[model samples]
Target: MDSFVNFFKKIPNKFASSAKELGKVQGIAIIAMLLALRVVLGMFANIGLAFNPYVKIGFTFLPMALVAYYFGPVCSMITACLGDVLSYVFAPAGASFTPGITAGYIIEACLLGIILYKEKISLPRTIICEVLVTLIGSLAINTYFIYMFYGLTYLQLLGLRAATLIPWAIIEGILVAVVVKALNRVPAISKNLPTT
Candidate 1:
């Protein structure tokens, strides 16, 4: 614990200052690839879904958070919004733009990146963070949109969606932790660690 604390204290002086910062180049590249991957994933995810459009795999946020974690919360937020813009620009007709979805993605990705930017990257902590962000950040924002426009109180919508999303959320949470942790382990990515 003492060593850990000392290491953290040294971060700002050691890496944060001179550790060759990860600029917009990395951030933009990662986000662009992430957005493209999302489109491909979305295309595949649409198949076999008979009921809800929103219930498919939610892995898109993971990479944004990864970007944020490696870059910063502000970058994550910007990337998420940019992704929404790209998604809108590229999406075919009938797939209109949605500010609500963009807001939710930005919120979730920013929170995840901001929350774990300094904390030790344990799997448990990562999973908990993923769940917290998805539930409080993404779900809350989207549910409010549903409540305001679609006809449902926030709490009622929360209850309904929470219950419905429990399984999907759990699975995605695990997936996020696994995928991010694995990515973190990669030397190329880990070398570009967050600003302590």
Candidate 2:
């Protein structure tokens, strides 16, 4: 209803504010560094779980979440897209580049920004955000892409992806909360973060 409509209305303003971050040299440097980290982590550090090539556990989410926290949704979305594309370019995986998978990561970044930007980082909030991202971005969106590419039944794909996604989300949520809290203790880093 009205609240829902108002939420949509605010999105543009949020994006606008996020876009302004690009005007700052520090912002550009931070986002570029983080995006590079995301690409590297995605390419090399990912662990294939359950012997399923489709399912992976990676720390790429950390940089994306950090981007969301620092720069907001637009920057996070850009970072997500670039990270995926760059990873593919540097280390080609699968038969082809899948736009749907990139879309899933974009959704993940946006969700992270919406939940974490300018908000106090807490265990509950981080857990909820990660869970939602897992459900929507990984289980739903990425699964669809994987199904399309691999010709696997949707149910089978969902089951395989979910086997690790749930635990990974919870673990990642805890990690994000802890890392952000620890980072905030550093005056240099905290000074750069957006105030709630």
Candidate 3:
């Protein structure tokens, strides 16, 4: 129980530390480059399901995961929100701005940070983290946002969106594990990455 309480206590401290990164030039530059990568991936690298306009499979999660792993939750949240806004601005996609969707992205990034920051990058951990993020951030949060926007029943939205969750989680988990492991092989990036 004390351990659980301590874990909760650490969260705010982590967030504070991450928030402070915004003031650093190196942090800002890294985040800016990652944010740009996120926007490009979101705009050009996603595939919309033919049956559901709301369902998109994208690589934006890569940058979000990287930011979370590097800087922790607050910075990840900020990057996610900015990336979402910028993606929308650059490519309107015939939809008005939706804060709810951006909120989902924030939640996604926060979850990733909480799960991955300062932790060993392993396949099982990455898989579990991706699953949880998809379940909470994408399925639960974003589904509701889509329901609100498109006037679809919440259950319908969930049904449609859930179809991609497992596959996405597995594929992304493998990709994240492979990518981080590969990056760890590079001396420059490995120095920046948290040691396992």
Candidate 4:
């Protein structure tokens, strides 16, 4: 009972620490770099499966995940939002700009950031974060946008995306785990990062 109570108590402190850490110069620089990376990576990722133009599988998530791990949700959200807007400006993939998709990107980054920030990137955490991100960002949110703007059924979009996104999510979990482990080995970068 006491352990449960303490766990709940600690959650707020972790969030506070994460929020505070994002105000520093290093944090700002890291966020900027991540935003740029996301845009650059978007070039490679903008193309979707031929059958379904809404499903975009890409390597951009890795950098967003890293920003979340090192800087937390606030920075991650900013990076995601800005990256999406700029990526569109630089390379208009579809017919027009859809704010719903941009919102989905922000939500994805926030979810990933909240799940992985200040937490050791173990198999469990990595898998859980990837699953949540895939479901929320790719499946739920993206599906909605596609259905609304593209006149597709939600189920249809979900079914089409699942074929690729499920396997991609698993691979993403492994990739995130590997990157986290490698980053942990670099004290110069990881040492100064605040826990949570």
| Global local distance difference test of model 3 | 0.86
Better of 1 and 4 by lDDT: 4
lDDT of 1 by residue, 1-196 (tens): 9966775575454334222334546645665676677655544443323455333344566666566556656656666777667656665423356688778877876676656665556666766777787687656886776566556677876776676566665666677667767876788866755444
lDDT of 4 at 126: 83
| Clashes per candidate, residues 3 or more apart or on different chains | 0, 0, 0, 0
- For residue 185, what is the lDDT in candidate 3? 90
Cα shift from native, residue 40, model 4 (Å): 0.3
Give me the candidate number with maximum lDDT.
Answer: 2
Q: What is the lDDT of residue 101 in candidate 2?
A: 89
Candidate 2 residue 164 C-alpha distance from true site, Å: 1.2
Instruction: Give the Cα lDDT of each candidate.
Output: 0.62, 0.89, 0.86, 0.80
Q: List ranges where model 2 is wrong by over 4 Å.
A: 1-10, 51-53
Q: Residue by residue across 1-196, what tens digits does model 3's lDDT show? A: 9966876777877787778777878778878899999999989999988876778888999999988987889889999999999999999765689899899989999999887877778999899999999999999998887787777799987987888776888899889989878887999977764453
Q: What range of 10 consecutive residues in model 2 has the weakest lDDT sum? A: 3-12
Pairs clashing within candidate 3: none
Candidate 3: worst 10 consecutive residues by lDDT?
187-196
Q: In candidate 1, what residue range of length 10 has the lowest lDDT sum?
A: 13-22
Q: Sorted on lDDT, highest at the top, how do the candidates line up?
A: 2, 3, 4, 1
Better of 1 and 2 by TM-score: 2
Output the TM-score of candidate 4: 0.87
User: What is the Cα root-mean-square deviation between model 4 and the actual structure?
Assistant: 2.4
